[model samples]
Target: MTDLIKIMQQRQSCRSFSEKPVEAEKIVSCINAACLAPSACNTQPYHFYIAHAPEAVAVAAEYCKGEKVNKWVGEAKAFVLITQEHAEIPAANSEARKRDYRQYDIGLMIENFCLEATELGLGTCILGVFNEEKLKANFRIPSPKSIALVIAIGYPADSEIRKKHRKPLEEMITYLR
Candidate 1:
Protein backbone atom coordinates (compact mmCIF):
# COMPACT_ATOMS: atom_id res chain seq x y z
CA MET A 1 0.00 0.00 0.00
CA THR A 2 1.07 3.58 -0.61
CA ASP A 3 2.28 5.76 2.23
CA LEU A 4 -0.83 7.89 1.89
CA ILE A 5 -3.09 4.85 2.24
CA LYS A 6 -1.16 3.64 5.26
CA ILE A 7 -1.34 7.04 6.88
CA MET A 8 -5.08 7.23 6.30
CA GLN A 9 -5.66 3.78 7.77
CA GLN A 10 -3.50 4.44 10.80
CA ARG A 11 -5.02 7.80 11.62
CA GLN A 12 -7.04 7.76 14.86
CA SER A 13 -8.22 10.15 17.54
CA CYS A 14 -5.54 10.13 20.20
CA ARG A 15 -6.67 11.32 23.63
CA SER A 16 -3.45 10.61 25.50
CA PHE A 17 -0.03 12.08 24.74
CA SER A 18 3.51 12.10 25.98
CA GLU A 19 5.03 15.16 27.65
CA LYS A 20 7.35 15.67 24.73
CA PRO A 21 6.67 18.72 22.55
CA VAL A 22 5.89 18.65 18.86
CA GLU A 23 8.39 20.49 16.65
CA ALA A 24 7.43 23.91 15.26
CA GLU A 25 8.16 22.87 11.69
CA LYS A 26 5.69 20.00 11.83
CA ILE A 27 2.92 22.30 13.11
CA VAL A 28 3.65 24.74 10.29
CA SER A 29 3.45 21.92 7.79
CA CYS A 30 0.06 20.90 9.12
CA ILE A 31 -1.22 24.49 8.86
CA ASN A 32 0.19 24.71 5.37
CA ALA A 33 -1.82 21.70 4.35
CA ALA A 34 -4.93 23.34 5.82
CA CYS A 35 -4.28 26.45 3.76
CA LEU A 36 -4.14 24.34 0.64
CA ALA A 37 -7.62 22.89 1.16
CA PRO A 38 -10.24 23.79 -1.45
CA SER A 39 -12.49 26.68 -0.38
CA ALA A 40 -15.70 28.05 -1.83
CA CYS A 41 -14.80 30.67 -4.45
CA ASN A 42 -11.30 30.72 -2.97
CA THR A 43 -12.52 32.86 -0.05
CA GLN A 44 -10.10 31.09 2.32
CA PRO A 45 -11.85 32.76 5.28
CA TYR A 46 -10.47 30.47 7.97
CA HIS A 47 -8.06 31.63 10.66
CA PHE A 48 -6.14 29.36 13.01
CA TYR A 49 -4.72 30.18 16.42
CA ILE A 50 -2.10 27.76 17.68
CA ALA A 51 -2.02 27.25 21.45
CA HIS A 52 1.15 25.51 22.57
CA ALA A 53 1.91 27.67 25.55
CA PRO A 54 1.10 26.32 28.98
CA GLU A 55 -1.04 29.35 29.84
CA ALA A 56 -3.11 29.14 26.65
CA VAL A 57 -3.59 25.40 26.99
CA ALA A 58 -4.87 25.96 30.48
CA VAL A 59 -7.37 28.47 29.16
CA ALA A 60 -8.47 25.94 26.53
CA ALA A 61 -8.91 23.30 29.21
CA GLU A 62 -11.18 25.60 31.15
CA TYR A 63 -13.44 26.09 28.14
CA CYS A 64 -13.55 22.39 27.28
CA LYS A 65 -16.68 20.53 28.43
CA GLY A 66 -15.34 17.05 29.20
CA GLU A 67 -13.19 16.99 32.31
CA LYS A 68 -11.17 13.87 31.54
CA VAL A 69 -11.01 14.53 27.80
CA ASN A 70 -10.14 18.20 28.15
CA LYS A 71 -7.59 17.54 30.86
CA TRP A 72 -5.85 15.46 28.23
CA VAL A 73 -6.32 18.33 25.80
CA GLY A 74 -4.70 20.66 28.31
CA GLU A 75 -1.76 18.26 28.55
CA ALA A 76 -1.39 18.10 24.78
CA LYS A 77 1.80 19.67 23.45
CA ALA A 78 -0.08 21.64 20.78
CA PHE A 79 -3.57 22.68 19.69
CA VAL A 80 -5.08 24.68 16.88
CA LEU A 81 -8.19 26.82 17.40
CA ILE A 82 -9.90 27.08 14.03
CA THR A 83 -12.14 30.14 13.60
CA GLN A 84 -13.93 31.66 10.66
CA GLU A 85 -14.65 35.33 9.92
CA HIS A 86 -18.23 35.72 8.74
CA ALA A 87 -17.61 39.20 7.38
CA GLU A 88 -15.06 37.79 4.99
CA ILE A 89 -17.88 36.62 2.82
CA PRO A 90 -19.07 39.26 0.37
CA ALA A 91 -22.36 41.02 1.07
CA ALA A 92 -23.62 39.97 -2.34
CA ASN A 93 -23.88 36.34 -1.20
CA SER A 94 -27.09 35.12 0.42
CA GLU A 95 -27.14 34.66 4.22
CA ALA A 96 -27.83 30.93 3.91
CA ARG A 97 -25.02 30.41 1.41
CA LYS A 98 -22.57 32.32 3.56
CA ARG A 99 -23.43 30.32 6.66
CA ASP A 100 -23.18 26.95 4.93
CA TYR A 101 -20.08 27.82 2.90
CA ARG A 102 -18.05 28.90 5.92
CA GLN A 103 -18.67 25.63 7.75
CA TYR A 104 -17.96 23.46 4.71
CA ASP A 105 -14.72 25.35 3.95
CA ILE A 106 -13.50 25.06 7.53
CA GLY A 107 -14.31 21.34 7.64
CA LEU A 108 -12.28 20.78 4.47
CA MET A 109 -9.35 22.68 5.94
CA ILE A 110 -9.47 20.62 9.16
CA GLU A 111 -9.45 17.34 7.25
CA ASN A 112 -6.41 18.46 5.29
CA PHE A 113 -4.68 19.45 8.51
CA CYS A 114 -5.39 16.08 10.16
CA LEU A 115 -4.22 14.11 7.12
CA GLU A 116 -0.97 16.04 7.00
CA ALA A 117 -0.42 15.58 10.74
CA THR A 118 -1.02 11.83 10.35
CA GLU A 119 1.51 11.66 7.53
CA LEU A 120 4.02 13.38 9.82
CA GLY A 121 3.51 10.69 12.49
CA LEU A 122 1.60 12.99 14.81
CA GLY A 123 -1.64 12.14 16.61
CA THR A 124 -4.63 14.49 16.62
CA CYS A 125 -8.27 14.68 17.68
CA ILE A 126 -10.81 17.23 16.51
CA LEU A 127 -12.51 18.63 19.62
CA GLY A 128 -15.99 20.16 19.35
CA VAL A 129 -17.19 20.28 22.95
CA PHE A 130 -15.95 23.61 24.19
CA ASN A 131 -17.19 26.93 25.57
CA GLU A 132 -17.39 29.15 22.52
CA GLU A 133 -18.00 32.40 24.37
CA LYS A 134 -15.10 31.83 26.75
CA LEU A 135 -12.83 30.72 23.93
CA LYS A 136 -13.60 33.81 21.91
CA ALA A 137 -13.06 36.07 24.88
CA ASN A 138 -9.88 34.31 26.01
CA PHE A 139 -8.43 34.12 22.53
CA ARG A 140 -9.47 37.70 21.72
CA ILE A 141 -11.31 36.56 18.61
CA PRO A 142 -12.59 39.84 17.14
CA SER A 143 -15.09 38.27 14.79
CA PRO A 144 -18.71 37.61 15.79
CA LYS A 145 -18.86 34.46 13.69
CA SER A 146 -18.76 30.91 14.95
CA ILE A 147 -15.60 29.27 16.23
CA ALA A 148 -15.83 26.08 14.21
CA LEU A 149 -13.46 23.59 15.85
CA VAL A 150 -10.37 22.91 17.89
CA ILE A 151 -7.84 20.15 17.06
CA ALA A 152 -5.52 18.70 19.67
CA ILE A 153 -2.17 17.53 18.35
CA GLY A 154 0.68 15.58 19.92
CA TYR A 155 2.59 12.27 20.04
CA PRO A 156 0.40 9.32 20.99
CA ALA A 157 0.76 7.39 24.22
CA ASP A 158 1.27 3.61 24.21
CA SER A 159 -2.08 1.81 24.14
CA GLU A 160 -4.07 -0.82 22.30
CA ILE A 161 -7.13 0.87 20.86
CA ARG A 162 -9.14 -0.89 18.19
CA LYS A 163 -9.56 0.74 14.83
CA LYS A 164 -13.06 2.05 14.13
CA HIS A 165 -14.82 -0.01 11.49
CA ARG A 166 -16.31 1.63 8.42
CA LYS A 167 -19.22 0.57 6.24
CA PRO A 168 -18.18 -1.43 3.20
CA LEU A 169 -18.23 0.25 -0.21
CA GLU A 170 -20.91 -2.15 -1.42
CA GLU A 171 -23.25 -0.81 1.25
CA MET A 172 -22.42 2.87 0.70
CA ILE A 173 -22.14 3.15 -3.05
CA THR A 174 -24.90 3.15 -5.63
CA TYR A 175 -24.80 2.94 -9.45
CA LEU A 176 -27.20 5.14 -11.38
CA ARG A 177 -29.03 3.31 -14.16
Candidate 2:
Protein backbone atom coordinates (compact mmCIF):
# COMPACT_ATOMS: atom_id res chain seq x y z
CA MET A 1 0.00 0.00 0.00
CA THR A 2 2.84 2.40 0.77
CA ASP A 3 4.46 1.56 -2.56
CA LEU A 4 1.29 2.56 -4.34
CA ILE A 5 1.04 5.70 -2.25
CA LYS A 6 4.56 6.67 -3.23
CA ILE A 7 3.72 6.29 -6.86
CA MET A 8 0.61 8.39 -6.39
CA GLN A 9 2.61 11.09 -4.67
CA GLN A 10 5.09 11.20 -7.52
CA ARG A 11 2.42 11.39 -10.18
CA GLN A 12 1.28 14.89 -11.07
CA SER A 13 -0.27 16.69 -14.00
CA CYS A 14 2.82 17.82 -15.88
CA ARG A 15 2.29 20.90 -18.02
CA SER A 16 5.91 21.50 -18.96
CA PHE A 17 7.40 18.79 -21.13
CA SER A 18 10.75 18.54 -22.78
CA GLU A 19 11.12 18.07 -26.52
CA LYS A 20 12.65 14.64 -26.00
CA PRO A 21 10.34 12.02 -27.45
CA VAL A 22 8.86 9.35 -25.24
CA GLU A 23 10.04 5.83 -25.91
CA ALA A 24 7.56 3.57 -27.68
CA GLU A 25 8.25 0.76 -25.24
CA LYS A 26 7.42 3.00 -22.28
CA ILE A 27 4.08 3.92 -23.81
CA VAL A 28 3.35 0.25 -24.45
CA SER A 29 4.19 -0.57 -20.87
CA CYS A 30 1.73 2.06 -19.64
CA ILE A 31 -1.03 0.58 -21.79
CA ASN A 32 -0.25 -2.92 -20.60
CA ALA A 33 -0.40 -1.78 -17.00
CA ALA A 34 -3.74 -0.09 -17.70
CA CYS A 35 -5.20 -3.36 -19.01
CA LEU A 36 -4.55 -4.92 -15.63
CA ALA A 37 -7.24 -2.69 -14.11
CA PRO A 38 -10.45 -4.50 -13.22
CA SER A 39 -13.58 -3.57 -15.15
CA ALA A 40 -17.26 -4.19 -14.63
CA CYS A 41 -18.27 -7.60 -16.02
CA ASN A 42 -14.79 -7.80 -17.50
CA THR A 43 -16.01 -5.38 -20.14
CA GLN A 44 -13.09 -3.04 -20.70
CA PRO A 45 -15.08 -0.44 -22.54
CA TYR A 46 -12.21 1.75 -23.60
CA HIS A 47 -9.41 1.98 -26.15
CA PHE A 48 -6.16 3.93 -26.14
CA TYR A 49 -5.11 5.56 -29.37
CA ILE A 50 -1.45 6.51 -29.29
CA ALA A 51 0.01 9.33 -31.35
CA HIS A 52 3.82 9.62 -31.32
CA ALA A 53 4.83 10.52 -34.81
CA PRO A 54 5.47 14.21 -35.25
CA GLU A 55 2.55 14.72 -37.58
CA ALA A 56 0.14 12.64 -35.55
CA VAL A 57 1.19 14.21 -32.27
CA ALA A 58 0.84 17.66 -33.78
CA VAL A 59 -2.70 16.98 -34.90
CA ALA A 60 -3.66 15.52 -31.57
CA ALA A 61 -2.07 18.43 -29.72
CA GLU A 62 -3.97 20.89 -31.85
CA TYR A 63 -7.28 19.26 -31.00
CA CYS A 64 -6.40 19.18 -27.31
CA LYS A 65 -5.76 22.92 -27.09
CA GLY A 66 -8.65 24.90 -25.57
CA GLU A 67 -9.16 28.64 -25.10
CA LYS A 68 -7.78 28.59 -21.57
CA VAL A 69 -6.92 24.97 -20.95
CA ASN A 70 -4.50 22.32 -22.22
CA LYS A 71 -2.60 24.84 -24.29
CA TRP A 72 0.63 23.29 -23.04
CA VAL A 73 -0.07 19.95 -24.69
CA GLY A 74 1.60 21.17 -27.86
CA GLU A 75 4.99 20.43 -26.34
CA ALA A 76 4.21 16.86 -25.38
CA LYS A 77 6.13 14.23 -27.30
CA ALA A 78 3.16 11.87 -27.43
CA PHE A 79 -0.58 11.85 -26.83
CA VAL A 80 -2.99 9.13 -25.89
CA LEU A 81 -6.64 9.46 -26.76
CA ILE A 82 -8.81 7.43 -24.43
CA THR A 83 -11.95 6.50 -26.32
CA GLN A 84 -15.11 5.12 -24.76
CA GLU A 85 -16.39 1.90 -26.26
CA HIS A 86 -19.68 0.04 -26.04
CA ALA A 87 -20.40 -1.82 -22.82
CA GLU A 88 -23.02 -4.46 -23.55
CA ILE A 89 -23.61 -5.45 -19.92
CA PRO A 90 -22.05 -2.96 -17.60
CA ALA A 91 -23.52 -4.58 -14.49
CA ALA A 92 -22.65 -8.17 -15.37
CA ASN A 93 -26.34 -9.10 -15.78
CA SER A 94 -27.04 -8.06 -12.20
CA GLU A 95 -30.20 -6.21 -11.15
CA ALA A 96 -28.26 -2.94 -10.79
CA ARG A 97 -27.85 -2.65 -14.52
CA LYS A 98 -29.02 0.94 -14.79
CA ARG A 99 -25.71 2.34 -13.60
CA ASP A 100 -23.11 2.34 -16.34
CA TYR A 101 -19.60 1.48 -15.12
CA ARG A 102 -17.62 2.39 -18.19
CA GLN A 103 -16.62 5.75 -16.86
CA TYR A 104 -15.40 4.21 -13.62
CA ASP A 105 -13.46 1.58 -15.50
CA ILE A 106 -11.84 4.24 -17.64
CA GLY A 107 -10.86 6.20 -14.57
CA LEU A 108 -9.23 3.17 -13.01
CA MET A 109 -7.31 2.39 -16.15
CA ILE A 110 -6.13 5.98 -16.48
CA GLU A 111 -4.88 6.03 -12.92
CA ASN A 112 -2.98 2.85 -13.50
CA PHE A 113 -1.51 4.28 -16.67
CA CYS A 114 -0.39 7.44 -14.93
CA LEU A 115 1.12 5.56 -12.02
CA GLU A 116 3.07 3.32 -14.36
CA ALA A 117 4.33 6.33 -16.28
CA THR A 118 5.43 8.00 -13.11
CA GLU A 119 7.32 4.90 -12.08
CA LEU A 120 9.05 4.93 -15.43
CA GLY A 121 10.19 8.54 -14.92
CA LEU A 122 7.74 9.90 -17.45
CA GLY A 123 5.30 12.77 -17.06
CA THR A 124 1.63 12.91 -17.97
CA CYS A 125 -1.21 15.40 -18.07
CA ILE A 126 -4.83 14.42 -18.59
CA LEU A 127 -6.79 16.82 -20.79
CA GLY A 128 -10.57 16.94 -21.04
CA VAL A 129 -10.95 20.17 -23.00
CA PHE A 130 -10.34 18.88 -26.50
CA ASN A 131 -12.41 19.09 -29.67
CA GLU A 132 -13.82 15.60 -29.72
CA GLU A 133 -15.28 15.83 -33.18
CA LYS A 134 -12.04 16.98 -34.71
CA LEU A 135 -10.08 14.31 -32.90
CA LYS A 136 -12.54 11.60 -33.95
CA ALA A 137 -12.48 12.70 -37.58
CA ASN A 138 -8.75 13.21 -37.79
CA PHE A 139 -7.94 9.99 -35.96
CA ARG A 140 -10.43 7.96 -38.02
CA ILE A 141 -12.46 6.96 -34.99
CA PRO A 142 -15.78 5.51 -36.11
CA SER A 143 -19.14 7.02 -35.37
CA PRO A 144 -20.73 6.59 -31.93
CA LYS A 145 -17.37 6.24 -30.23
CA SER A 146 -16.46 9.20 -28.05
CA ILE A 147 -13.12 10.50 -26.82
CA ALA A 148 -13.30 10.45 -23.06
CA LEU A 149 -9.91 11.99 -22.31
CA VAL A 150 -6.59 12.94 -23.82
CA ILE A 151 -3.22 12.47 -22.08
CA ALA A 152 -0.10 14.40 -22.92
CA ILE A 153 3.03 12.34 -22.31
CA GLY A 154 6.75 13.08 -22.34
CA TYR A 155 9.76 13.86 -20.17
CA PRO A 156 9.14 16.72 -17.79
CA ALA A 157 11.12 19.87 -18.43
CA ASP A 158 11.32 20.34 -14.69
CA SER A 159 12.00 17.10 -12.89
CA GLU A 160 11.01 18.27 -9.45
CA ILE A 161 7.91 16.65 -8.01
CA ARG A 162 5.32 19.14 -6.82
CA LYS A 163 3.22 18.84 -3.69
CA LYS A 164 -0.33 17.47 -3.93
CA HIS A 165 -3.24 18.94 -2.02
CA ARG A 166 -6.43 17.08 -1.17
CA LYS A 167 -9.16 16.96 1.43
CA PRO A 168 -8.41 15.03 4.58
CA LEU A 169 -9.68 11.46 4.81
CA GLU A 170 -12.02 12.29 7.67
CA GLU A 171 -13.74 14.89 5.56
CA MET A 172 -13.73 12.86 2.37
CA ILE A 173 -14.86 9.46 3.64
CA THR A 174 -16.99 7.81 6.34
CA TYR A 175 -16.77 4.33 7.78
CA LEU A 176 -20.00 2.57 8.69
CA ARG A 177 -18.29 0.38 11.22
Candidate 3:
Protein backbone atom coordinates (compact mmCIF):
# COMPACT_ATOMS: atom_id res chain seq x y z
CA MET A 1 0.00 0.00 0.00
CA THR A 2 1.03 3.60 -0.52
CA ASP A 3 1.97 5.96 2.30
CA LEU A 4 -1.38 7.76 1.99
CA ILE A 5 -3.22 4.43 2.24
CA LYS A 6 -1.23 3.48 5.31
CA ILE A 7 -2.05 6.82 6.90
CA MET A 8 -5.70 6.38 6.00
CA GLN A 9 -5.77 2.95 7.60
CA GLN A 10 -4.16 4.30 10.73
CA ARG A 11 -6.81 6.99 11.12
CA GLN A 12 -9.59 5.93 13.43
CA SER A 13 -12.16 7.46 15.73
CA CYS A 14 -10.32 7.36 19.02
CA ARG A 15 -12.57 7.16 22.05
CA SER A 16 -9.88 6.80 24.73
CA PHE A 17 -7.13 9.40 25.12
CA SER A 18 -4.10 9.84 27.32
CA GLU A 19 -3.43 12.70 29.73
CA LYS A 20 -0.66 13.95 27.46
CA PRO A 21 -1.44 17.22 25.76
CA VAL A 22 -1.29 17.79 22.00
CA GLU A 23 1.37 20.17 20.76
CA ALA A 24 0.29 23.54 19.40
CA GLU A 25 2.61 23.34 16.39
CA LYS A 26 1.21 19.95 15.42
CA ILE A 27 -2.34 21.25 15.63
CA VAL A 28 -1.39 24.20 13.45
CA SER A 29 0.13 21.85 10.89
CA CYS A 30 -3.07 19.84 10.84
CA ILE A 31 -5.08 23.01 10.33
CA ASN A 32 -2.84 23.97 7.47
CA ALA A 33 -3.51 20.61 5.84
CA ALA A 34 -7.24 21.08 6.43
CA CYS A 35 -7.16 24.39 4.65
CA LEU A 36 -5.72 22.72 1.56
CA ALA A 37 -8.85 20.65 1.06
CA PRO A 38 -11.05 21.52 -1.93
CA SER A 39 -14.33 23.33 -1.44
CA ALA A 40 -17.28 24.26 -3.57
CA CYS A 41 -16.64 27.30 -5.76
CA ASN A 42 -13.32 27.67 -3.96
CA THR A 43 -15.23 29.07 -1.01
CA GLN A 44 -13.95 27.41 2.16
CA PRO A 45 -17.00 28.51 4.10
CA TYR A 46 -15.79 27.24 7.47
CA HIS A 47 -13.86 28.26 10.53
CA PHE A 48 -12.09 26.21 13.19
CA TYR A 49 -12.15 27.17 16.86
CA ILE A 50 -9.34 25.43 18.70
CA ALA A 51 -9.39 24.81 22.43
CA HIS A 52 -6.12 23.36 23.63
CA ALA A 53 -6.00 24.95 27.05
CA PRO A 54 -7.05 22.78 29.95
CA GLU A 55 -9.97 24.95 30.96
CA ALA A 56 -11.18 25.35 27.39
CA VAL A 57 -10.87 21.65 26.73
CA ALA A 58 -12.85 20.86 29.86
CA VAL A 59 -15.59 23.25 28.88
CA ALA A 60 -15.75 21.91 25.32
CA ALA A 61 -15.67 18.33 26.57
CA GLU A 62 -18.71 18.89 28.74
CA TYR A 63 -20.71 19.99 25.72
CA CYS A 64 -19.59 16.98 23.67
CA LYS A 65 -20.58 14.46 26.32
CA GLY A 66 -23.98 13.97 24.85
CA GLU A 67 -24.50 10.18 24.58
CA LYS A 68 -22.97 7.31 26.51
CA VAL A 69 -20.20 6.50 24.04
CA ASN A 70 -18.97 10.09 23.99
CA LYS A 71 -18.53 10.48 27.74
CA TRP A 72 -14.86 9.66 27.32
CA VAL A 73 -14.32 12.83 25.26
CA GLY A 74 -13.43 14.52 28.52
CA GLU A 75 -10.11 12.71 28.37
CA ALA A 76 -9.04 14.46 25.19
CA LYS A 77 -6.63 17.33 25.77
CA ALA A 78 -7.77 19.48 22.86
CA PHE A 79 -10.89 20.14 20.86
CA VAL A 80 -11.45 21.66 17.39
CA LEU A 81 -14.87 23.12 16.92
CA ILE A 82 -15.92 23.47 13.26
CA THR A 83 -18.45 26.12 12.36
CA GLN A 84 -20.30 26.43 9.07
CA GLU A 85 -20.27 29.86 7.41
CA HIS A 86 -22.12 31.40 4.53
CA ALA A 87 -20.54 30.59 1.16
CA GLU A 88 -20.56 33.45 -1.29
CA ILE A 89 -20.10 32.08 -4.75
CA PRO A 90 -19.02 34.62 -7.29
CA ALA A 91 -20.85 33.60 -10.44
CA ALA A 92 -21.61 35.72 -13.43
CA ASN A 93 -25.21 35.50 -14.70
CA SER A 94 -25.83 32.29 -12.79
CA GLU A 95 -27.78 31.26 -9.71
CA ALA A 96 -25.42 30.25 -6.90
CA ARG A 97 -27.82 29.57 -4.04
CA LYS A 98 -29.56 26.57 -5.56
CA ARG A 99 -27.69 24.02 -3.40
CA ASP A 100 -25.62 24.06 -0.25
CA TYR A 101 -22.11 22.61 -0.20
CA ARG A 102 -20.94 23.83 3.18
CA GLN A 103 -21.39 20.45 4.88
CA TYR A 104 -19.44 18.62 2.19
CA ASP A 105 -16.65 21.17 2.29
CA ILE A 106 -16.49 20.90 6.07
CA GLY A 107 -16.33 17.11 5.88
CA LEU A 108 -13.44 17.25 3.43
CA MET A 109 -11.56 19.66 5.65
CA ILE A 110 -12.19 17.53 8.74
CA GLU A 111 -10.87 14.46 6.96
CA ASN A 112 -7.71 16.29 5.94
CA PHE A 113 -7.25 17.48 9.54
CA CYS A 114 -7.76 13.99 10.96
CA LEU A 115 -5.50 12.36 8.41
CA GLU A 116 -2.73 14.83 9.16
CA ALA A 117 -3.24 14.27 12.87
CA THR A 118 -2.97 10.51 12.40
CA GLU A 119 0.24 10.98 10.42
CA LEU A 120 1.57 13.11 13.29
CA GLY A 121 0.96 10.26 15.76
CA LEU A 122 -2.11 11.83 17.32
CA GLY A 123 -5.64 10.50 17.74
CA THR A 124 -8.84 12.22 16.67
CA CYS A 125 -12.55 11.64 17.06
CA ILE A 126 -15.10 13.60 15.01
CA LEU A 127 -18.12 14.28 17.14
CA GLY A 128 -21.47 15.40 15.80
CA VAL A 129 -23.45 15.11 18.99
CA PHE A 130 -22.75 18.22 20.98
CA ASN A 131 -24.74 20.88 22.83
CA GLU A 132 -24.76 23.49 20.05
CA GLU A 133 -26.56 26.18 21.99
CA LYS A 134 -24.35 25.82 25.03
CA LEU A 135 -21.19 25.72 22.98
CA LYS A 136 -22.25 28.78 21.05
CA ALA A 137 -23.20 30.64 24.20
CA ASN A 138 -19.97 29.78 25.99
CA PHE A 139 -17.65 30.21 23.02
CA ARG A 140 -19.20 33.46 21.89
CA ILE A 141 -20.01 31.97 18.47
CA PRO A 142 -22.48 34.14 16.64
CA SER A 143 -26.09 32.95 16.30
CA PRO A 144 -25.95 32.88 12.49
CA LYS A 145 -23.09 30.38 12.35
CA SER A 146 -23.91 26.71 13.03
CA ILE A 147 -21.60 24.24 14.65
CA ALA A 148 -20.78 21.48 12.17
CA LEU A 149 -18.57 19.12 14.14
CA VAL A 150 -16.34 18.81 17.19
CA ILE A 151 -13.01 16.98 17.01
CA ALA A 152 -11.36 15.54 20.10
CA ILE A 153 -7.58 15.40 19.82
CA GLY A 154 -4.86 13.89 21.97
CA TYR A 155 -2.53 10.93 22.39
CA PRO A 156 -4.19 7.56 22.65
CA ALA A 157 -4.20 5.86 26.04
CA ASP A 158 -3.76 2.52 24.32
CA SER A 159 -0.63 1.95 22.27
CA GLU A 160 -1.89 -0.76 19.97
CA ILE A 161 -3.74 0.21 16.83
CA ARG A 162 -7.06 -1.60 16.57
CA LYS A 163 -8.20 -3.16 13.32
CA LYS A 164 -10.80 -1.24 11.35
CA HIS A 165 -14.06 -3.10 10.74
CA ARG A 166 -15.45 -1.97 7.46
CA LYS A 167 -17.50 -3.28 4.58
CA PRO A 168 -15.61 -5.11 1.86
CA LEU A 169 -14.68 -3.19 -1.28
CA GLU A 170 -16.90 -5.39 -3.42
CA GLU A 171 -19.92 -4.58 -1.33
CA MET A 172 -19.09 -0.91 -1.04
CA ILE A 173 -18.33 -0.24 -4.73
CA THR A 174 -20.39 -0.36 -7.90
CA TYR A 175 -18.84 0.02 -11.34
CA LEU A 176 -20.66 1.11 -14.49
CA ARG A 177 -17.80 0.16 -16.74
Q: Which predicted model would earn the best TM-score?
A: 3
Model 3: per-residue lDDT, tens digit, 81-102?
Answer: 9999989887661565678889
lDDT of 2 by residue, 89-164 (tens): 8345776477789999999999999999999999999888999999999989996999999889999999798888
Using lDDT as the measure, name the better of candidate 1 and candidate 3. Answer: 3
Q: For residues 1-177, could you state the per-residue lDDT of candidate 1 as single tens digits?
A: 997777777778888888778997899999999999988767887888888777887787678747545656765778788888643556676664535577788889888899998888788999988888988888888757677898888888864445779998899999999
Model 2 alpha-carbon miss at residue 28, Å: 0.8
Candidate 2 lowest-lDDT run of ten: 90-99
Point out where model 1 deviates above 4 Å. 67-71, 87-99, 159-161
Instruction: List the global CA lDDT of all models.
Output: 0.81, 0.92, 0.92
Give the runs in model 2 whose Cα sits over 4 Å from its true position: 90-96
Which candidate order results from sorting by TM-score in descending order? 3, 2, 1
lDDT value, candidate 2, whole model: 0.92
Model 1: worst 10 consecutive residues (lDDT sum): 87-96
